[model samples]
Target: MDGVNAATTDPLARIAELPGVDEAVAEARTVVDRLLGHRVLRRRSADVSLESALRGAHASAVLDGAEAPLEQVRSGEADDPRVKGALRVSGELGQLVETWPKAPRQALARLHTLAAADGAGADRLGRPRSAAEQAEDPAGLGAPPAPIEVEVRLEALGALLERRSSAPAPVVSAVVHGELMALRPFGWGDGVVARAAERLVLIERGLDPKSLAAPELGHLQRREEYTAGLRAYLTGTPEGVRTWVLHCCAAIADGARDSLATCEALKRG
Candidate 1:
């Protein structure tokens, strides 16, 4: 992921300074510093990574409408296909984030493969859905863009990511997640995959370099609001976009605190 951080020109510089976003970005930086400043977490890196993966998978699965107990999901006793797919993608995030910034298409394909392989069928993994195969977004926002639209938008998104905008990583990441969710390009499992991609931005951008935060958990904790935030992003208005960005910042800050909780849990155990 080091390649993803080449300190390029900040493509998102202007957007970061927009109305409500500056405040959100500032608070996000504070939350990030607070998380990274934890001495106990530095000493327990492995446990932090493990808990992040576990909680992230659990929370993402719930957002996809497959709520399951943490222990059951952890033990592989959760028989739901959605949960199973989210688990696979979340577990593989460490390897995936490394590829995301440098070769976004390749990275995104790999993510779709993992999230869709079990549930969507082995044959369909790693590709967009056919017009015949495209379905309603799991988030129930609307019917997906046509296959051609998906292709065009996806190409644009890949370019945006590869350019590695200097926008605050969290802000860039929120846009990435939003675009993915909006495009719903894949044949299956985009919600979980989108969150994983967002996490990759945070990881590679050094906002949460230890990979110990599960912002997905924050979304799950505020499911209705989270869904509304995404809906607002779909509106494409400036205010709507700012609402989404601020919502994402709050989730990320909550995720930082989630890491603190993981630190407490690991300390106790």
Candidate 2:
């Protein structure tokens, strides 16, 4: 949302030069093919809920660990509120994935407003105090901190989406993730909002997010590795960020491939 200035440099080409990136991409492509097939089968099934279908496909093959069964989620028997919340968020996210792109910033702002009203979780969109308030001398700190940075960021995101021909998927992804994480603009459910925003971006680009898979699920799967990668990325090293991005891309491809395979099997049956 900042501006083109806030837009980070695309690292795909640089990442491509890294060792094993190509191989990773190839493996990812294969996995995506299979996931796509499974999605087809689920689509063919009249009784399958879209949320359940994606959760199952993502959990088993694309995610790092064993997925919770679809029946278990639908049964609403989980004692843990977090698990229930996760499932509910996942379903809402799936629905958003099916919808086309909306104004990212405005949507986020509205979500924050709703979150604040309902005491959902976090209130990220609160106003910032003027610099005068920060300093003893009124004008020394310069103009007051505007309350509209969030709106500005949202507008910037919309602009980015409008003129995205030059940006690669990973770069777009990075920007989106960085903004949501940095802003934390909602009163609650920041994590879910961030993930939902990512899915929305993918869907807007005509990418099948349902097939692309959830990186959080993957992060959860390989917890140590995932945390290490995130730490590396955050520590001014690009290696971990590159690793995480490629891992996500690979998961997307793998999930799609698995979905495709399931669809084929269902068809044969």
Candidate 3:
């Protein structure tokens, strides 16, 4: 895969051609489609969506180092600002879905603002970090790209989102997620925002329109692989990019399985 600043006419289309991406994407689609067909979703999809959102937020917060149990998150006892921010971003995702493809940079700023509401000052909320500012390294991936590099990559990403492409939704979603993870554009809450953005892409692109699958849960379940995948993406090699995309596809399938379990539990009751 080319760099984020690549001049290709369709970056995601190129990504779709990466080895194993198509197979992984097909598997993820099969899982998600099966999840969409689960009996409980017909009558109790609202319940499932709510549960999925809560679980997704909780998992994303855990990735941010909040680490509360799901029940704690559900009962409103998890008061970590990261937890609160992840919940806020989850709630805001539906509203941002439509905005994402049209104006990705603006949508990202909105997500960062929601995710960093408590952690960042008023002056810093939604603002990309300046060259002098340092981002917190939650993934232990080391220092982020310099500010100018961040700007260029983000601009390129924004353009990619706004343009029409023939790539599969999973491919596009993986790219969006990987690029944001690598960029860490903001000083705070970039991880939450990036995960939220991935969900939004999956929703907007129709991979998981109701947002039932909790990919964050899948990522959390495979925490070591999650970190390793992102680190591989940061390496900018074809093999590394392939590994990251396959990891995301597997996460989507795992998340769908988790949602299916939610439906099953609801059915048994």
Candidate 4:
């Protein structure tokens, strides 16, 4: 969080103007709105939110190669360290939501602290990788940025997050997600931290305040597309960025639909 500032230019606003971005965002919003309006939420949002956390953690674990079933996760039978760490991170989101806007770095560190707790040494849990370290390339996205570059970009991103953005929440969240995935700042659990950060943005920015939607599940379902979109984003072209943003929005919509199904099931029984 080195270069944080109260800057005037909204980088995310510019990203929102990219072709088809608005449409995709609008659709995601609509689906989320539908999920929000469900009668189940009015009475049992707490229940839905709890269920969502389980599903989200399970999906995130699967993406990290843990591959636990939802029931296994809920029953506390998924003993993989990655799955357990993901569950830890999911359980902590409510507390971190308030901290995210004020101190994103702290929030991120806490996320990593939880997500990589069992895998990383205690000293390395929240620390970004140094030049001597090699980040895990789970997605096989070539080499991660150098330690210096990761630091600079993270500082700039922190600066951006400290202020209000004219861009939609979807755009901001997508950028945060893509950038972290691309940066791989920490040596372990960077992907889990990145996606959790995106969830915080979507929560803080009013898109899905209760965290009912499991966008991680959407990403899990569309694994190939998610990877391709992230790869496109890493290319640093307008087309690539737009592709990633659209893909993220689609995943969000899919998450909303999944939540809506959850609502239906809860309503029936």
* Model 1 CA RMSD to the hidden true structure, in angstroms: 4.0
TM-score of each: 0.92, 0.59, 0.96, 0.95
Cα distance off (Å), candidate 1, residue 9: 9.7
For model 1, how does the per-residue alpha-carbon lDDT over 1-269 read when each residue is reduced to its tens digit?
44334333443555565688878877877877886777777678788778788888888888887868989988989988778888788778778767888888788889888887767877778888887896546677887688999899888888878877768987898888888888887857889888988988998898888787788988888878888988998998777778888888888888878888777777787
Best by lDDT: 3
- Which of the predicted structures, 1 or 2, would earn the higher TM-score when compared with the native? 1
Mind giving the per-residue lDDT tens digits that candidate 2 earns over 1-269?
33333234423344444566557655654564455445444456332235434453334222212245555655755333334444444454444442324445555544334323332334233222232222111112122223366456656656665554444453455446544544444423444445446545654554554434444545445546544544444444457656655655554454444445445666676
* lDDT tens digits by residue: candidate 3, 233-264: 98999889889999999999999999999999
Candidate 3 local accuracy as lDDT?
0.91
What TM-score should be assigned to candidate 1?
A: 0.92
Q: For model 1, give the 10-residue run with minimal summed lDDT.
A: 2-11
- lDDT score for residue 113 of model 1: 88
| CA lDDT, every model vs. true structure | 0.81, 0.45, 0.91, 0.90
- Say which prediction, candidate 3 or candidate 4, comes out ahead on lDDT: 3
Off by over 4 Å in 3: 1-8
Ranking by lDDT: 3, 4, 1, 2
Candidate 4 overall lDDT versus native:
0.90
Q: Which sections of candidate 4 miss by over 4 Å? A: 1-8
